[model samples]
Target: MSKTNAARILDRLKLPYEILEYAVDPDDLAAESTAEKLGLPPEQVFKTLVARGDRHGVCLAVIPGSAQLDLKALAVLAGDRKTDTVPLKDVQPLTGYVRGGVTALGTKKAYPVYVDELMLTFETVAVSAGKRGLMLWLAPQAYLTATQGIVGAIARSSPP
Candidate 1:
């Protein structure tokens, strides 16, 4: 398989990860759908989100696809008064990654990366490979180390 920017970075770090690929549905880019395509639980498939804090600049939020980011919680963790998702139009320009393909590993900007504390609960978690239709699965610690991610309660379960 061809390497993505994220894959090359991982290789440089010597981080061992498994790459998984699935069919893409341009009309349905939801993380839940991606999880289903891979036959994995929604919680195991993480989604990368970019947000800007009032006090801080832009940052990346890696949360479970099954969960929703808590702006208030994120703001507290970011040491800011508030946090808001970056506009869809700005995602690619800001992070060098488009929606559904943003990963903390490789970005246009090295914005602070904050991962959901819940991620550590799992033995392995999946994240975008900085491209659509691809995901990287590795030990939680490996991911944290790769991105120098801050672990905190930055996410809350979505309502049923």
Candidate 2:
């Protein structure tokens, strides 16, 4: 299998991780859908979101499929008046990855990264391996360390 941006970052950081690949329909894959396809719990899978902070250039948020990013919390963490998610068009050039394939690591620029504190509860967490149909399972701390991510309670329950 080809190494993804996430895998490349992990390898560069010398962190141990396992890559998992499965069939995925790029047009229809969602975090929840990917989790189901891989036979993994939704909470174990995370999605990477790029947000624009009022003063903080660009920031990355990592949250479980079962949770939602708390914009207010992120604003506070970023010390900004507010924060807004970057649109799909802007994300690719900024992060050098498509919406469903963005990884916290290997972005075009080194933006501040935040990972939901809840992820620490799991021994291993899965994140996009920089492409559709691929994921990586590794210690959450390893991910944080590799990305220089800040841990915070920046996630909220998903809407019904």
Winning model by lDDT: 1
Give per-model TM-scores: 0.98, 0.96
Worst 10 residues of 1 by lDDT: 1-10
Compute the lDDT of residue 118 as modeled in candidate 1: 85
Worst 10 residues of 2 by lDDT: 22-31
CA lDDT of every candidate: 0.92, 0.89
Residue 123 displacement (Å), model 2:
0.3
* Total clashing pairs in model 2: 0
lDDT for model 2: 0.89
- Flag regions of model 2 displaced more than 4 Å: none
Task: Report each candidate's C-alpha RMSD, comma-separated, in the order given.
Answer: 0.7, 1.0
Q: Whole-model lDDT, candidate 1?
A: 0.92
